[model samples]
Target: MDVDNGMLLCPTHDALFDKGFISFNDDGSIYISNKIDKREYELLNINKDIKLNFKREQLPYIKWHRENEVQ
Candidate 1:
């Protein structure tokens, strides 16, 4: 479904991003869905310091994912 609006993410992050369980900012700071529990996030063992590299063009795609698919 991603076509031109895609990036190469690690499997965990990729799935999470596609499902809208996670997202990235223009600054590439990662954010988890508020629906996710703290314990669950801790158990996932995602890197607390990880950041994605996003370009301006990707904003619309990411926004569409967040607005339409995100829980």
Candidate 2:
């Protein structure tokens, strides 16, 4: 995999992401899957306000992940 295809995340968030419970918008904001209950957001420490800094080259990978992995 290309380095740009990788993102550094905490174990909890990483697992959530890998499980398709979360993704990200092109603007870098977090995209929580509807499959997740609203209450779980607080329990998981996730919120709509969260965002990551992404490079332009990473957008394509992000798009692919969102399409294929995210619920």
Candidate 3:
């Protein structure tokens, strides 16, 4: 939703991002593992530390939710 990144989110599972350029399925769901790639991996490592910091800044809202939730 910000100006820096172009990411798409799945409502069902807010943990996943459509960074692979794939849209939602007919059932309105997405499987991220099937879309993982070198760029995503690199982005993960690069963003891991940041994701650990200010989680709300991450694209996937579920990540922030999980990061804030108490187990």
Write down the TM-score of every candidate.
Answer: 0.73, 0.94, 0.21
TM-score leader: 2
lDDT: worst 10-residue window of model 1: 41-50
Number of backbone collisions per candidate, in order?
0, 0, 0
- Span of ten consecutive residues with least summed lDDT in model 2: 39-48
> What value does the lDDT take at residue 57 in candidate 3?
38
**Top candidate when judged by lDDT against the true structure:** 2
lDDT value, residue 47 of candidate 1: 62
What lDDT, from 0 to 1, does candidate 2 have? 0.91
Q: Model 3 TM-score?
A: 0.21
Report the C-alpha lDDT of model 3 over 1-71, residue by residue, as the tens digit.
Answer: 56423343335223344233223222324323434574774554323222222233343544433344313
| Pick by lDDT: 1 or 3, better one | 1
Candidate 1 lDDT tens digits, 1-71: 75659888878778887788887666777777887787787666666567877878888887777778776
- Which lDDT value does model 2 have at 13? 92
* C-alpha root-mean-square deviation, each candidate: 2.4, 0.8, 12.2
The total of clashing pairs for model 2 equals 0
